[model samples]
Target: MTGGVVFDPLLPWPLIATLGLVALIGVTLALWRGLSGWALRALAAIALLGALAGPVYRVEDRKPLSDIVVMVEDASASQNLSDRPAQMQAAAEALAAEIEARPHTELRRVTVPDGAGDEGTRLLETLAEALAEEPQGRIAGIIALSDGRVHDIDRAPPLPAPLHLLLTGRESDWDRRLIVTNAPAFAIIGEPVILTLRVEDSGAVPQTANIAPLEISVDGGAAQRFEIPTGRDIDLPLTLPHGGRNVIQFTVPEAEGEITARNNTALVQINGVRDRLRVLLVSGEPHAGGRIWRNLLKSDSSVDLVHFTILRPPDKQDGVPVDELSLIAFPTRELFLEKIDDFDLIIFDRYKRRGILPASYLENVANYVRQGGAVLVAAGPDFASADSIWRSPLGAILPAEPSARVIEQPYHPALTDLGQRHPVTADLQGEENWGSWLRQIEIETTSGDVLMQGVEDRPLLILDRVEQGRVALLASDQAWLWNRGFEGGGPQLDLLRRLAHWMMKEPELEEETLWAEATGQRMRIVRRSLGDEVGAVTVTRPDGKTLDLALEQVAPGRFEALYDGPEIGLYRLQEGDQKTVIGLGPAAPREFEQTIATGEVMEPLIAPTRGGILRLEEGLPRLREVRAGRPAAGRGWIGLTPRDAYETRDVRQTPLLPAWAMLLLAAGLITGGWLREGRR
Candidate 1:
């Protein structure tokens, strides 16, 4: 209980003061005039003045509250490294026990787990939330058991008491990490792009660890090794092998005594894009469908088209001189022999053998296909003639042979069973609403998969693979009828585009492949194949663990399975001969970025509160009580300030003097002063 004197005035203070002043002056005059009762008069004036200024005694009933000490346990992924988990558990238990032993102190524990994705250790944010929930005055101190590698330090809250850090890792702990400081998200194919990387050593690194062996791999291919010096950035020149997502893995073999290999390997995914597409369009004669090929190739701003038409053969009598006739001689030598490799795709539109291109030039074309080149043949009536290009050396690479027959009935083109699953024709819109074609060349399939059929189910589209290249045969040249919306137009543009890209070796258009797409920790694994069914894919995790994941067919040839990965790193996928690598989260998780434990990150936040950082590996510091505004940490001990906080249960107020008592005292003093004056 506590008591204090308070006032409740009966009259205005100004009026009371004026009356007292007048009475004091009267008494002074009486004393100056030799009045003996002046002292009594002064006493009477004091009694009346005191009554007007009321005084009361106040009391409060109180209950003491315990001081709260917030202890934040950093249970993040980084704290699980090496022996830190053991250290954290030991420190936490010791601190809790000490707080419980101290009188008038309570321990509030907050455990911070790993943040979502690569947000890293959110120790400061967790601390701020704990502080906001408690009374600031009742909080004696704030303690964190962490490696001090907090990602959200800027969010540290204002401290009401000292903030102490019980650092978790040992001073001798070291780590080697591979960091990709600069990597472009998209790079031009066949053009060198610079990737900046560094192999860094942290903590107590050995002198012999200055030079490290680095391995680099693209799309899970063979790795190339190099000796690189640590602590400096190395610029690596990389040219993407294909157009699509290219996964590049950079690794520095784990040093003998380093903390983890997780940080030693970094994965970077760059999308490869073509700078320009060079196409050579060779037309045997000017026909209606010739413009369709020209229009399709010209529509894309990225394509460079070189078109040549054999208007008159060398054997034909033109009846006009070469100079008088407005015709440019075809650069047969430059196109077929010299610069054939410069073009990404070669298209033969209704092209038939003429005296102009000899058998040698045609043979060269066949060689081009076998040496990683693409050839697309669009057959017309000429394809079934005696002079058909199929009769030349190029027929060796051609997927089909002309049967010397032509179907002249209007028939709608339809996808074969294989075409419905092939990337070139799968999921094509408006398939049921396609227009009809006037004619198709009869052909006998010698090799390759038949994707489409026409008139009496004859092969209309055939795709094949030559040694290192690709070849495609379309038996009809009347696909332009679809472009003209005969009966109803079809997806001519889409079909042609997919066919062209597939021949050019676009990664997404491959007939058989394995790949993965990641959203947060969830991965969608996809398998594209031409067979009826594919076996389960074997997934190799970053930690050398393997699992067989079964896939369900979502489309004709597309199979998929969803997996929620528990960790962040590169994952290797394999189905049969197809293999691919995908990264689930960041190549290097933020928690493992700086695995070596240190207190530097928390020093600034702790210093202002006069707190100290002690390593748990050395020993758990003894807890002690210290006064506010003084240093809360010492050589072998940490301190918490005791807050003398209390709650008022009840309050009571009593007047010092009652109204009746004040009146009686005033009357008595006045009467006494009157009698004394009479006697005087």
Candidate 2:
């Protein structure tokens, strides 16, 4: 469709120059010698030489592509917190209208969604993806309408053109939030753990009260009153009443003219564990099993055991008088009544009906069990006799009735099915290192969990709970052999330690309880049990949304799950009937503003663009164009970075001269000049 003049030289420049010199000499000689014909011939030869050079004419047509302008808009949770969303919407509408009015300029609008679940906002990533779809030369510029708080700033790509930001929000915006500075994942029961908290004031607080009354509650109980100085950190020491996940809620009463009460109250869950256990062991008569119980409990450092043994009876007549017997009088009333609540656990080791403890005292002991007290009875042959303690008023609290039957046999201690299912006894099953108890006492019972059995399938250990109290009955009187290392005795201390602690309403004894411990954003969900199987666990988030997930058993009685909380707040866990709530982040962190618009955050970035940061409070400005690189906003028009690009299929080019025509004109002129000179 088009052509142009181009050169194609066949000879070197030196040969061409030599040919020109010879033609010039011939023309000069003819003119000087008066030979006009010779001069004409020389000029013709020179022109013919110049015609050998190649030339052509070329023409072309071209098409121009439109320049692209990217408009990125951010509408996240933070943006919505203020009037930023409406501002962005208005700015976007006006910008679109302006870009549309421009000639040969295309607009690419990219809307970035809120970042995935608490990751904040990502605007640059969306912009980069939109840019990749188009050619770099076609892009004019990028304009972002948002608050500057971008969660994914690393995603910003190198811009081929200028980048501009249009900020949102006012200059005086601020916020206040509750911060839980310190909380432990675990604390000792009935022991105070120090928690650090702070109430911060941000921006313009309407009411500045010096002291704010803070109410603290544990496990949904009545809150206790405390006064904390506002705008400062306060350390509070709280004691846990019971073991397990202890939910503590701390709240500040709303003040007049307060901005928000959402951050006033915060929930914290601290798991309660036992630092030490106090146990009282009373023996009516010395027996092998009684000594074993004493040795097991006494060996543990965390267990404070107060053991009393009655070596003498009150009415016994002997050669030695009562005063000379030197036996300390057992303070039955003081121990069984006055100081009963002080001890966490009481064990009757082979105790029988003695004249020392009256019927009323035994009745009081039974009442103690009904009132959340823990009692463990170790029975011997005396249990089957007329002197059995089961015949006393304490009989009502006994897990089993002593029958007048004695089963004398050597048998290995075993775990029953329900015992293997219970948290306290399940850990004893399949243990290879424990020596078998050779002797056991026969018992009859309609209730109580049969945790261990002896030879011939006679129950050896029984455990039960009445009211809020716990009871453990060991039917064997020959367990002392294991404690004395009679035949490779093993783990005697460990077994008794677990048994006593479990009876004292320990948190670890719960067969099914949901508990979560957190460190920063990382959380560990643990389920302690004595059962062989547990159903799926359902976790409730702070937002009241429930997530059901199956758990993996890590050990015989422990199941655990690890999770990272998306945002800091209280979270609940449930498995079947067991449910526990724990705080992942602060009941409220100072920074959890849910709105996603980035107008406030982007103000600094927008300042460099020389663009006016106007609110949607005002009407949207019409888009106007200024010079490509100069100030874009002078009067009414906005500036856009220019991207110059053009395409061509054909081009036209002109040559300076034609070789044959030049040769003819040169020969004629030389002949004329030579003839004139020769005539003169």
Candidate 3:
């Protein structure tokens, strides 16, 4: 119960003040004239004025409220390292027990878990939500159990009571981490790109741990070791060996006293792309299909096209000078000898060995294919003639050799069994309506894949890989009929683009490859092969555990599997001779990025509230209660504020003087003073 004095004026304050001022003036005048009743008049006037003020004695019945004490628990992944989780559990239970044993104190437990994606630990955000629910005046204290590796430090809310952090982890804790500071999203194939990375040592590191052994691996191959200096940035120069998504892992061998090996490794996936597709088109004779090739090549912004058409053969020696003939001599020497290796792809559109290019030039073209260059041949009826380019040294690299026969029957093209399993022709199965080719050269496939068959099931399209380069041969020149919308057209554009890109070694068009792409926790894995029977893929997780996943055929050559990852890290996928690496959420999660714990992040917020940050490494400090504006923490103990808050259950008020009592007293005093004045 609490008691206080309150007022309830009977009349307006202005009128009551005027009446009192008039009485005071009259008493002052009487006192100045030596009136004997001046004292009595002043006493009666004082009591009357007191009655008008309506003073009341107020007594309140209040029930004391329980002071709320909040306990914030950090259950993030970082806190689980070493014995920190155990430390947090023990500290939280002990703190809860102490707060519970206290008289009229309520304990509020707020748990902060590991964040999804790369959010790490949003400790402050969770604490703020808990603090917002309670009245600030009733909060006696807030205690946090964390590793001090909070990600949202800037979001700490204004604290009302003393805030204490019982930090986990030992003073001797140390950690080594691999940091990928800068990485590019895409890099040109066969070109060296610099990746910025570093290996750092944090916490109480040893003196001899200045150098860490870094292991680097591309895809899922064997790791290569290098000694890298700790605590400094290092630029790693990498050249993508193949085109497509390349997974590069930079790791450091785990050391003693380190928190975890999760941070010792970092994964980076850089997509490999061709900077330019340089195509050289050689034409022995100009035809309608030559324009199709030119238009297709010219349509792509990344392709640089060079066209050379033999307007007049060497045999057609017209009676005109070379200059006057309005023809520029073909630079066969420059194209085949000077800078042949610089070209990415060479196209032979009905090209014949008509002495325009010497036998040496043909041999050089063959050598170019063997030395990592792509060649595509669009055969016509002339390919079956004795003047065909197949008679030259280029025949060694060609997939098919014509038998000097041309079949001139209109027939629709068809995909062979191998084509159904080849990425280049996989999507062409059961095409709605295909255009027909009127002429096709008869040829036998020798050391190449027959992707398409013509009349009598002859090899129409063949793809072959030479030494390091790739080659393709098309037996018909009537593919343009599809482009012209014959019989509602066929997939002519799609087929040509795929064949060209495949010859150029595009990773997406590889006949045999395994790779995975991820969005958040969902991963879509793919396996491409040319064989009809494909086996399951073996996936190795970041922890060296393996699982075999059976693939489902999505398309002819595409095998797919969808998996939801339970954790964030690098995943290694392998199918037959193919192997690749992929990162799910992060190569190294944000939670493990900095595993060492410290109290600097919450010091600013704790300081303003006179709170103390004590580490559990030196034994959990004892908790106590303290008054506001005083020291809230000491060497061996932490303090909570004594709120002294209460709820008023009932209230009563009684007037100090009743209206009748005030009137009788004022009249008796006035009458006694007047009679005394009259007698005098």
TM-score of each: 0.92, 0.69, 0.89
**Per-residue lDDT of candidate 3, residues 567-661 (tens digit):** 88988788888887788877788899888778898888888899998888788798777899888999979999989899999999999988789
- How large an RMSD does model 3 have? 3.5
Which pairs clash in the backbone of model 3? none
Query: Model 3 Cα displacement at 23 (Å)?
Result: 8.0
Question: What is candidate 1's local distance difference test score?
Answer: 0.91
Please give, for residues 373-450, the per-residue lDDT of candidate 1 as tens digits.
999999999999999999999899999999999889999999999999999999897778899999999999999999
Report the error of model 1 at residue 567, Å. 1.7
Ranking by lDDT: 1, 3, 2
Q: lDDT values of the candidates?
A: 0.91, 0.73, 0.88
Best by lDDT: 1
Report the lDDT of model 1 for residue 91: 82
Candidate RMSDs in order: 3.3, 8.9, 3.5
